[model samples]
Target chain A: MLKGKSILEPMDMTTAELEEIFDLADEIIANPPRFAHACDGKLLATLFYEPSTRTRFSFEAAMLRLGGQVIGFSEPNSSSVAKGESIADTIRTIACYADIAVMRHPKEGAPRVAANSTDMPVINAGDGGHQHPTQTLTDLLTIRRRKGGFENLTVGLCGDLKFGRTVHSLIKALSRYAGVKFVLISPEELRVPDYVRRGVLEANNIPFREVKKMQEVLPELDVLYMTRVQRERFFNEDDYIRLKDRYILDAEKMQLANENMMVLHPLPRVNEIAVEVDSDPRALYFEQAKNGMFVRMALIMKLLGIEVE
Target chain B: MIVNSIERGIVIDHITAGTGNRILDYLKIDTKKNTIAFIMNATSKKHGRKDLIKIENVTDVDLTVLGLLDPNATVNIIENGKIVKKINLELPKTVTNVIKCKNPRCVTSVERNAPHIFHLMDAQTREYRCEYCDEIVSMKNE
Candidate 1:
């Protein structure tokens, strides 16, 4: 039933279905060449309204590795969107040429609108401060492989909690699993939004605590998820500069964390994580990025109903 | 101490004082088509002061919206000048097309013809948030 399904939000698929994708991704991770042609002759349309070179490159790399062709624009100006075409019109038009479409737009719920207009499958890359289901998939896959499973883990989400789409999606996804404790770390001004706090955490009766500093809750977390303050989300540069460095994960702070804890980041980071910590075995953000492609491969094949050999 | 009874209509009682007119404005009770009588400053055993809205010869009301406006309101249906049924209103879990999301970044704001939907997250806290964006739609202002 996951085939031909539009992924507008993280809750689109059940946990068991997500695990199926992870199982296929794990198989691909073990031997990449075997499933190289699993999606032969297929086409993937990456319609990015806003330019995200890393996410665009990852989805493209995933489709290419599966022997599928990739098409679509990286920026709005390069496509018919610049001509004032609605998202509904553009996605419906693209469905004629492409088998599956992955879209990243600056407007929240743009993909959902497109999905309703197209018969072809639509995947949300990252909406404007909304759900990023694929990124949630990447985080889940990484956590499953690295930390064994989603249960009995104290996950600390740090920085820009108010506007981090990745954090919002991850919290919604992970809160569904058993024994997950949330330690929300951010300045008082930038705590997780009330909708997230009330919708996911309080509604589910999950235990969570709010704190100001990362170091105060370092040793307690099994996973330290770092996020950068997006420049576009801020109107004033001075506030961004003042608040950006407040949660920087330096080597000294990392030393206070548990030995088994894994550090993660949705990349293109701007000094949130120290360069020296990249050499540490606990740093999983790079591997997390690599795993993103594999998971995307699994997702594409699953949505296309392609039987991976 | 008696307001004339209607042949067939809806009588909204137990509304918090001064809110009956707001409901009339929201429901757009046209006085030309249907007769509306506002019973304001009525003394009640339970409420110190209460308001009532009596609409003559009207039925098939959208009870969902009335529940959101005031959870404590009561509606009585009259048929042939006799009370047929009484309805006690409770807050709906989700409301659609009622309140506009105030957030500029919200999809509901930009997308024309998009339905404005709000989900009641907390009943005790009276918290309702936009379905698309998570902006808390404060009930106090409206």
Candidate 2:
């Protein structure tokens, strides 16, 4: 049912649809060979208007693993975009050549413009601190696998809540589940925007509390989602420097967390999590990164309507 | 101040006192085509002071724009100097190209010929979020 659909935000897919993608991801994980040829004759075009390492690679790897051909520009300067091509024109041209397209742009809603411009399924990789639905998918998949289900779980999202698109998307996605509570840990300057707080959480009547310190809520959490305070998102370097190191998840902080609490981070993490924590069974960020590829594979298949036995 | 009522025209009443000119400019009602009486800061029992507009032989003003500009404003259809239809304005669900999103990081800010779009998020606060960037914009002075 997700066929030919563009994923612009986490809320675009219903819970049932999300489960469908996750279930497929689970199957692919259990037996990768089964879905290897799912996209045998298809092509995936990656349009990264901004610099990226993980998202681009994972998307490319996902397509390659699915027996699909990949074509795209890692840098916008190499493409027609450098010639001042609009997103609409670029996407419209891409639709003719590729079966599906994934876009990551510095401008918020750039992918949305692309999605609306073409019939080819568009995936928003990350759009200028806006919604990153793919990262949300990866996070949800990791949480589901680790915690069994989303209900009645206290999710502590620590650091840079304001510009962390992954945290915003995850919060919105998780708010749909029953009895889910949010412990938002961020400096007052980096608090989640009004739309996420008032429009998503408060409007949905989700239980949540905003705190300046992560340790205050660490023990009560079922999941701790860590984020880096992105320098690119800030207008002032002084503000970024002041807030960047506000919350770091070290070995000492890990001891205060619940034994079963899983630590997740959308990676390329800049020292927010200590290297020592990686050895802990609870640190699932690396595995979460791997799951990002698998989930994207499933998503590409679902969007392309490629059935796999 | 009593503005002459018009037959076969429209009457927009109870606009927040100071915003009448802005709303009039937004409506872009041609002054040469239709005779318009703009009454600003007029004394009123209901609003203490209000702005009212009467346009002769024009009744097709976009209510949505009017609603967004000033939701408290009332639109009255006049026929033969008698009120035929009165519209109570509500916040529009979506508006296109009415107000530009000020967020520099938004796609609409750079994209060529991108239509400025916003959707109502909080009607009580009159908050409209940009369709692209999700930046909240209040219609007051926009």
Best by lDDT: 2
Note the Cα lDDT for every prediction shown.
0.87, 0.91
List runs of model 1 lying over 4 Å from the truth.
Answer: A116-119, B1-3, B14-52
DockQ of each: 0.50, 0.80
Error of 1 at A100 (Å): 2.9
- TM-score leader: 2
Residue range A1-309, candidate 1, lDDT tens digits: 689999888899899999999999999999999988988899999998887977899999999999999999987897787787877778878999999999998877778778878889999999887778898899889999987789989999999998889999999999888999999999986788877898889989999999997888999999999998887777689988888788889888989999999899988798999999999999999999999999999999999999853
The alpha-carbon deviation from the true structure for residue B75 of candidate 2, after best TM-score superposition, in angstroms, is: 1.4
Q: How much is B92 displaced in model 2, in angstroms?
A: 1.3
Residues A1-309 of candidate 2 have per-residue lDDT tens digits of: 899999999999999999999999999999998877888889999999899999999999999999999999998889888899899999999888999999999999999998888888999999998899999999999999987889999899989999999988999999999999999999899999988998899999999999998887889999999999999999999999998888889999999998999999998899999999999999999999999999999999999888875
For all predicted structures, in order, the TM-scores are: 0.90, 0.94
